[model samples]
Target: MVSIFLRSLVYNVLFYVLLVLWMLMAIPTFLLPRRVFMRVAKAWARSSIWLMSAICNIKVEYRGVEKIPNGPLIVASKHQSMWETFALLQFFDAPLFIYKRELGWIPFFGWYLMKSRMIGVDRDGGMRSLMEMARRAPKEIRGGRQLIIFPEGTRTPVDATPNYMTGVGQIYASAGVPCIPVALNSGLFWPRRTFMRYPGTLVVEFLDPLPPGLARKDFIVRIKASIEDATKRLVDAARAEQAQLFGRVPAKT
Candidate 1:
């Protein structure tokens, strides 16, 4: 426990230090083309991942790069930990996220989101807000940016009951693009709302793509099943490995 706390403290301190510096350095990116700004954003993510590995003793390994299509698509990923927010950015070309409208109000971070031209959804604005999201999403798709959305709407702990939402289906129906379901066991290592980072490999698997033109109902069912089932397997596998090594499953810290 002492070792974990010390490592977490070092990782947390360095992570924020790098984050503040990166944000200040990236202010110039706002004046450049969006693509160039995104390249800088990916660099920041890479640096953060490196810090996590070097200091926190955590590493991320993902597969299924070939499964990602060349054209515009929807990357409907499992929301586990916050790690995927930036880690997944490096894999897609011009990826746009569907975030809460209020998040765009943050200082430099929000400015970064605006410059990236991400899709913002007004979750509390009722059906009208959703309709607006549906309407605006197609423009991003037409621009050839991959849309990364969490089907669960929020991060879920490992092995928790899934709360897959229909909003993702709405996006898919409106965007008219294939949905690539990505499953990961990141919560096992990084967790949500926690400072203790575990020493382990985080596995992110990109499942087969759900092709466009399916009925909304069918698309929702397929994506939920694909992501949930794969995510459960990852969570279970990680737990088993942890039990084997530690003589008991390690709880998220």
Candidate 2:
């Protein structure tokens, strides 16, 4: 706990200070060539990830990145860690992130998000609200952007039970875009409500996108199962890898 607190303190100072400077940089992005803004911000995300990895002693391993396309596809990811958010920003092309609208109220960030026109959902939203998402999503995709959606809705704890939300299914059906299910073992190290990042590798694996033919209901069910199965595999593989490091085999996922 002491380590967690101290690390959080140090990280907050470093990150927020940088965030302020980044906001100033955003002014030019709003006016001049947006590519310049993206370039600087992308570099910042990479540097941020590097620093966090060092301070938290956590590493990330990715597979099947080749399967990811360069268009406006919907991403259904398991929500287990905040690291995934910042880590994702490192992907440069600037994906259209689907998150709660409330995040848009966070000082300069909210302003930045508003300027960027990032999609932020309101939970108390009506049908018109989702219709808006459906509409904006396609336009963004057609304009060459990826949408990152956490179908589980929220983060789950490491020792807590996990469940799936139907939003992912709705988005795929409504948006009529290819959906990619990505699984990561981040919860093992990046537990919710804690800064005590563990020393280990978070494995992110992307399965192939859902093909047409299946109805929306069946598509949803299959996607939910696919993500869970991939997550289970990562958990088992992480345990096995750790066990091997200690000269033993893990029992189960």
Candidate 3:
């Protein structure tokens, strides 16, 4: 317990320090081209992943990376932990995240998001917000940027009842691109609102893409099925690995 506490504490401190430094370094990105800005942004994510492994003893393993198709596509993922927010950036060339509008208010961070041109949605604005997101998404998709959205909208504990939202379907139908479903077991290790990060492998798998032109209902069904099924397997596998690593199974948080 003490070891875990120490590791988590060190990770949190070092992680935030790196974040601030990266934000400072990213100030000049606003003047650069979009692709250059994305490269800078991905460097931050890569460094954070390195810190997670070096400080917290949590390693990440990605599967089915080859399944990611070229060109503009929708990458809809299961939201279980904050790790995916940064870690997933390395996978795409120029990825645009469908994130909350309030995130655009944070000082340097928000400035970076604006410069990066990430699509922001006002969650409380009801249907209008989703419509706005859908409206903005196609522009980016047409510009050859991959749209990364969380179908669940927010993070949930591993094995929690999934709350898949309609916004993803809206984007898929509007963007007219392939939708790649991503599943991960990140929550079993770096859970929400928790300082303790367990030492084990975190798995992220990109499932086959659902080709464009499916009806909204069918798109939603396939997206949910692919993510939930693979996510459940990852969660179960992580728990089993945790049992072997720590000598006890970790309860879903």
Top-TM-score structure, candidate number: 3
* Candidate 3 lDDT by residue in tens digits, 159-206: 789988887787788888898999999998899998788889999999
Among all windows of 10 consecutive residues in model 3, the one with the lowest summed lDDT is: 126-135
lDDT, candidate 2, equals 0.71
In candidate 1, position 26 carries an lDDT of 89
lDDT of 1 by residue, 10-81 (tens): 998998899899899889888899998888889999999999999877767888888999879889999888
Task: Provide the overall lDDT of each model, using Cα atoms, as 2-decimal numbers.
Answer: 0.86, 0.71, 0.88
Runs of candidate 3 exceeding 4 Å displacement: none
The predicted structure with the larger lDDT, 1 or 3, is 3
Query: What lDDT score is found at residue 172 in candidate 1?
Result: 85
**What is the model-wide C-alpha lDDT for candidate 1?**
0.86
TM per candidate: 0.95, 0.83, 0.97
Find the candidate with the highest lDDT and give its number.
3
Task: For candidate 2, write residues 130-243 as lDDT tens digits.
Answer: 777767776776577767777767787543466776666666666666777888888766667755555457788888887644677898788788888888888777766656
